[model samples]
Target: MKHPVTPDGRYFVVRGRLWRMSNPKLDETQRSKLTNRLMSARRAVRAAKTANDQSAEAAAHRAVDDAKRVLGERGPVWWNDGSPDLNRHLAKNTPYAEWYGQIGRSRPGGT
Candidate 1:
């Protein structure tokens, strides 16, 4: 299911927590490449787990991290405004609290 993105576009909310988005400035080609790499790394991680290879799993995890860093989904905030990286924080505990509340109230069956 698609999650809600904050108005600023810096993050998308999932289960009420903020997750950073990829850098909007990245060239399409580069973004696609990095995303592909990330997927491959994830597959490798699954394979390693299935094979019970601890070292390979660790390396795959690192590769996934590297790709995410390059994609601007991790590491640092991609926006230039110097806003604190609130990624992984609950929306109710951040500046997005009111917005998140409004979303819930607007949804069907929302309290």
Candidate 2:
């Protein structure tokens, strides 16, 4: 995963490396939910940067707006240090579990 850097100018270093995806505690369901969130975040970050750099100020702002729109409420919930806090909530009363369901379950139609 790439990380944003501000060594001088704003830039994200492309680590250009993919890591294995797995979680013993996360059932298939949770893993899937996290994966989707991660993917969406990656795309959003990319879009935001692209908009910030490639497009006109207005258009770039729109791209960033669209990217943020895509991010939805998953912004705060993050996969940190190889684990996810399912207890995190986008709202005062909502939890990841309540929103995305249980984790670590095999997908439907398995042997």
- Cα lDDT tens digits, model 2, 74-108, are 33333345544322222213222222222212323
Candidate 1 positional error at 21, Å: 0.2
Model 2: CA > 4 A from native: 1-21, 53-111
TM-score (C-alpha) between model 2 and the true structure = 0.30
Q: What is the TM-score of each candidate against the true structure?
A: 0.93, 0.30
Best by TM-score: 1
* Cα lDDT computed for each candidate against the true fold: 0.92, 0.37
Error of 1 at 25 (Å): 0.3
Q: After superposition, how far is residue 93 of candidate 2 from its true place, in Å?
A: 46
- Tens-digit lDDT track of model 1 for 37-59: 99999999999999999999999
lDDT of 1 at 36: 98
